[model samples]
Target: MGDKIVIDARGSSCPGPIVELAKAYRNSKVGDTLELWATDAGVRADVQAWAQKTKNQIDSITEQEGKIVVVIKILNR
Candidate 1:
């Protein structure tokens, strides 16, 4: 099955948005798309690190309405 997960963590603090992204990872599979929206300035670094640790592929990073939007493509482990 195909699926997409979007986590809106805008207004959250450090680690909060990253945590949500991690949670989304648990339920996601290879080829899945997970979009994370975070307002915390640290989210970009944190999420990138997390994806590196977990072997996920970062598809894109964009800024939307003052929030950082990250789209991660789940990679096969």
Candidate 2:
């Protein structure tokens, strides 16, 4: 319920969003939730898979006006 870290990756291509998320994850504390905004359509699936692979928790994913918003909680490190 704290202030979530928001990474604006809008207008970025595939991997860009995930990269930003990764960087933010590294700097984030455990249990912190991150919001990633991406314009790429593939970022949703890519981020989900990355989160799963890394053992992170995906809180939710929302799409609005050609942008995808992914809420991910840092977990398991």
Candidate 3:
């Protein structure tokens, strides 16, 4: 995998995080990676659902000092 694209949608809530992710995902290709840092806790579930829907892979989702750090790998598109 190449370097990851970081999406820092920290303060945004609800669809904000997902929207940013979607945009990045749309521009990304298979094998491209993304690192998202969100403050909204709902991002975890949102990312999970998006990943499933898009047929992508969630490499990891960890909490670091209240920040939800999500690592996703584009598996298909």
TM-score of 2: 0.88
The candidate with the higher lDDT, 1 or 2, is 2
In the range 1-75, model 2's lDDT, one tens digit per residue, is: 545899999987755788898889888877788999999888878887998898989989999999899998888
Ranking by lDDT: 3, 2, 1
Q: Over the stretch 1-77, how does candidate 1's per-residue lDDT look in tens digits?
A: 55788999988785588888878788888888899998888888987898889888898999968989999888854
Who is ahead in TM-score, 2 or 3? 3
**TM-scores, in order shown?**
0.88, 0.88, 0.92
Off-target runs (Cα >4 Å) in candidate 3 are none
lDDT of 3 by residue, 1-77 (tens): 56689999999975688999989888988888899999999899999999899899999999989998999998888
Model 2 ranges off by over 4 Å: 1-3
Each model's backbone clash number: 0, 0, 0
